[model samples]
Target: MNSSVPYLLAILGEGVVPPSTMVCHGDDLGLLRGDGVFDATRIVTTEDGTSRIDHLEEHLSRFARSIAGIDGPTPDMDSWHRLIEDAARNWRVPGEATLKLVYTNGREVVPGPPRGFLIIAPLSETHMEEREGINVLCLSRGVTSDAFADAPWLLGGVKTLSYAVNVAALRYAKSQGADDVIFTSTEGYLLEGPTSGLVVKANDALWTTPTGTTGILSSITVNTVFEAADDNGVKTATRLMRRDEVLRAQGAWLLSSIRGVVPILSIDGHPAPHDDEMTHRLRVWAGFEE
Candidate 1:
């Protein structure tokens, strides 16, 4: 382990410990069945050691909702706040990092209480690289835009840890020499990226896929971007968009919490139109500079 690498890991009741140490049991349902929920936010540290966590309250609220969606008890927000603060204080690295809150249903057989933890680690350079630009592969999510309308069991808006499929999609995209993936619905509507929200610029307005009926997770970053755009006198809307429309858009981006905003350079090997000026404006609006 590199001693120079700073990290903080805190179990709900256990305080902080070395990140490399073993924490969970083999029978934990989060491990055995991929039953868990998580939320991540960018944590920025100044040269003076002061740190600020982006959208902390919003992420916590969403995290609690995700837990409930997975049949887990609503977590105590106060306790989570304390744990996060403790970990943040211990993480002395002076740069950008990610703070991830994770929760899982307890052991599968001898279940008692859900397990919760916080990991504060440095942000990935790859994420930073992608912010400049990326090529995406359009893949089928095998569901229609309205699939989540009445399907509570599908856990549409939930940010569950069951991300095997999402990860696989990204892996497949990489296998095809692409940097990311934009999942399209079976009905052929542009949905979202595996770990980010799809945002398009067309007709001088910002557009994104609808959340409630499209089974896409509500993206805090996208909402923040839209709010900033609104303040800057830009129009925003939510609508069902097709691949052809996205391909012909004035600009496209994949927006997420940690990565902020990343422009799409191409889709399925075809050059997608982009506006550098708009992308720069989005970065400014998203506070990506800080």
Candidate 2:
């Protein structure tokens, strides 16, 4: 690994790692019961002497919303903003790159001020793929939309660090020999992937599960693609996506902040037809193509 790259991981809580240049400590609650939330955004730099935060404000707003219900050990917004800005300034690469920001409820334990603050990780360009896509496998035993609507204990939409379930879902997918998993509701409506957004093209329209019903995080890439789809003559809609319909769609793509947009080649061991036109349009909309 190149020593020029700056990596910082800060722990907010007492009796943690030494407050050194790399790992810092704090007294926050995110470490105990995983009560905090976070959001990650990418940093894009062009050849025209310009640096742009692809979706900075939107991501921060989502972070704020994730922590709205918590009453104690809340994150400090002023400090959080400063840290992100500092991370952006730390960018030394010339082309496009990624910036990851995390904030958790800060307290020594569950009942004190939140224990996790913010940590920014800089991602180099080589860490990402230029033209690759994702392969997804569906899990039948996980939380469905109906289950989350009724129970609400899973906290499906929030970006909390207690992501054990999500990791488990992905691992289960890997066990089945796939890159990721798309969760479904008991009623057969599509929800989302563990870390990415679900999107499909059918009848000249772009569709995803409505945020209200699916309890999936409002994906920034999905929003941007739909906004730009109309100019390319693609219709857009969001509804309860039935599993059968998704399996039969013309094409599918998983959108995320870091990966940008990746097409789906297979689902549940079934090969999905690749539509070059749609992929080109989406890549263009996402700044990956002209």
Candidate 3:
């Protein structure tokens, strides 16, 4: 591998190693067929070397749920917790890095237990810049709002490793000079961003889209912000708003573990309402700011 690529740190059995270290074999289903589940959260390390993984328990709980969705064996929670702590302990020279946990079924033909590992890597400059704000493109998801209502096998709300379509949508948006994308259902109902959750401030309340039945992944970051808003006397809700209604909301943001809370400056070339003060406050609530 080229030395200039700045590969991330990875951990499998014990110590940290460069990401070049092969973690999976050719026959591994996660590699060949993308049959697995994964979750990621940000790790903030201050100048003084103090480090904290944001909302770790929430992410782990969600990870467990995804494993269960695939009918996998009970996750060794103790091992997972120990592995995360090891990664954080060895992760020096960090500002903001992601801690991602990947769990996959055994090899396609070979017999073995499930395979998994953790990786730590610095957050990209583009993600940091987007935290200031972003312009989004709304694209049709090509599915109805009820697509996953009775479909457990559809893996609704599961964070599977299959994300080619999501990446393609974001790539298409950036090709249009937009920073990100918010996918809309076939009937014009708002869903979510490719890698982030939607939060709209309307009628004096903070609202996010539904998770189960809607096939939207539940966002721990969005939930944290809403809980904080509630504690601050701000109303919180979950609903399916039309795409047009969301664009006209009092305020809006795409929130995630790594990027925290980001304002939507414009949608499809039309500027959306943005408030610097609110963005700052929301960032603090989501632990992206001090």
Candidate 4:
């Protein structure tokens, strides 16, 4: 690893440490069974060395909800806050970065408590490129729109560590010459992106998939964007949408914390409508614009 690239790691109870020097047991369920939850938000450091974490409280709330969804004991928010602060202060990078909070059930067979940690790393060029615009492939997620209604085992809405499927979907998109993926339900209802929330504009109104029954992870970025949009007098709604509806909408976007808002230029090799003015508005609303 290059020393010039800033990085920081902090364990739940432990203070910040060299990221490469930290170790986890081989049997930890977080690795062994992909049993864990995480949340990521942006961290920005100004020229004068002042750092601010975007939506920290909201991300922490969602992280706790994910832990509870997985039956893990409630975390000590105060300790997590201190650890995050320590890691951010140690980072010292004066640019855009991602701060992720991770928690996992402890060792598979060992009797122990849950494990938690925070990682702070600089944002990559790809994140910026994607935010400019992206072509996406619509992929079936192999579940009905209402799959999560009564299925606690599904772990829907929880940002779990088991992301093999999502990663595979993105890989599949890349294999198809696309930049990202929009996961649709088996019933053909638009769900969300591999790591983002799907939002579309139709009839001058902004629409996104509903979270509860669709198993869509509640997006902090989307929520923030909508709040800003509301303040700007833009109408917003949440509902199930078909692929065709999205394809024919005035515009489409993938909302995420790290990437902010990324416009979808094409879907399934078909040209989708683009609204430059709305895109700029969304960028400004999401704080992507200075």
Candidate 5:
């Protein structure tokens, strides 16, 4: 948007526009009511001025599912593909950045098609630092693990624009002198982080919470790590776990798109075991070895 904003490239539709260009208006549902869906992935730029987007197809598929969760029209995948390519082609800063896709339900004041756009920007230093390790607090989500069952309206597993609660959770954790939070169901089952997925090492296998009824947003990064682990003879599972179990587990980590894999150092002031080998392996599996 301004000169002070470091390395930003935006594409609203098939054309690239200035970072400060207005992509949405006041009446836009995404702004006024948070009726939108989005997804993001890592974009690594090499010294050769070439950028590579990881889990590109998986991000698109999940984004489509999010749009469907909101009963929105299907996005133009081809246009988005072209726009992403254009954005990546122009983003040759030779560093790690994020590629985000945003789609909203149309404007209410003046009818218009849904606003879809792509953004490429440099990653934050904080995110990079967290990749080293983190101390998280377990917070209650006020919903049972099965609260979303048979209730599509709950939008379980949907990546929506309404993230105020997530922001609040993170703020609360910061106030508590913690780096992040792991949301648990009212029944006390570990769900996920505000913006990341929880991956616990237990019984010599990699396990994460379930999605369907757990109201947990499925994590592409976790899936990528699990896939890599599978290839390397590690077992993986999807199941519900509690904070006590996480504290007693062999290891734990928060995996996400932008941040990659971040090992958990402690939870709620309770120390958890740290496995350097496991952390390094998870990072490499998640493609965030750097």
Candidate 6:
């Protein structure tokens, strides 16, 4: 392992390794093939060293969904939380930090026992801030056929370890001089972002796609936003939204745990309004009152 990569901390089951340890053969296989699903959850640490797992239970539930979707082994919530807390303790990250829990199928193509792997790494600084707004580029649905419909759609909702298509989509968006991409269905309905939720202000209400209603992994950020918005007398709803409605929205965002709530500056070449009242209201409601 290269010392320059800056390894903060790592936990392998009951064992802990420093920055110079090499992974097991099975771990290499799973990671090499991208045969795993993972979730990102942020932890808030106090100056005195006290730590609270933000939305821990919700993240664990999402982990269960990913495990079940890939027919992989499931870990007990109590035990998994313990592992996460242990890793976080070792990290000693100041303030708030994002923790990523990964579960892999252990490199077996055929059906076999799957104990998988778990990892906790420091999140990049880019995701920790409240972005001014995002510029999104529209992409094709047929290419990522997994995200086509509500349920049984092309594994769009599932957080599968396979992300070849996701990388390609983001790269293509970057080539067009955009910050991110908003994927839609063949029928022209808004779906989600590469790593975030579809959050838009429209019809004088806070709206997001009903991926949760369709058996998809309901985004914790989306739920948190709704809670905050509703508390502030803002109407929030989860429903099927058309592409035209999204482009014509008053204020738009890609809400996620790490990215917080990101506003959209442009969509498919058209510039959007910046710093609207709705944007400020939604951000405050989401606890990002910054």
Which regions of candidate 1 fall more than 4 Å away from where they truly are? 2-5
Candidate of highest lDDT: 1
Cα error, residue 89 of model 3, in Å, equals 1.0
Error of 4 at 187 (Å): 1.2
Per-residue error for 249 in candidate 3, Å, reads 1.4
Clashing pairs in 6: 36-161, 133-263, 134-263, 146-154
lDDT of 2 by residue, 13-41 (tens): 32123224453135455655677677777
lDDT of 3: 0.87
- Expressed as tens digits, the lDDT of each residue in 212-272 for candidate 6 is 4333347888898798878878798877776667767777788778667788888898876
For candidate 1, give the lDDT of residue 262: 92
- Report clashes for each candidate as comma-separated counts: 0, 24, 0, 0, 0, 4
Model 5 stretches astray by more than 4 angstroms? none
List the global CA lDDT of all models: 0.91, 0.68, 0.87, 0.90, 0.90, 0.68
Whole-structure CA lDDT of model 1: 0.91
Which of 1 and 2 is ahead in TM-score?
1
lDDT of 4 by residue, 1-290 (tens): 67877788888887887778654788888989989999999999987667899989999999999999999998999998889887877777788999989999988887888899888888988887888899999999999999999888999899999999999999999998999999989989889998999889999999989998888999988898899888989899998998788888899999999999899999999998889898888888888885
Displacement of residue 50 (Cα, Å) in model 3 is 3.2
Q: Where is model 2 poorest over a 10-residue stretch in terms of lDDT?
A: 10-19
Would you give me the overall lDDT of model 4? 0.90
Candidate 6 residue spans exceeding 4 A from truth? 1-6, 24-29, 46-50, 109-118, 128-130, 143-156, 212-216
Clashing pairs for model 5 are none
Per-prediction CA RMSD (Å): 1.2, 4.1, 1.5, 1.2, 1.2, 3.3
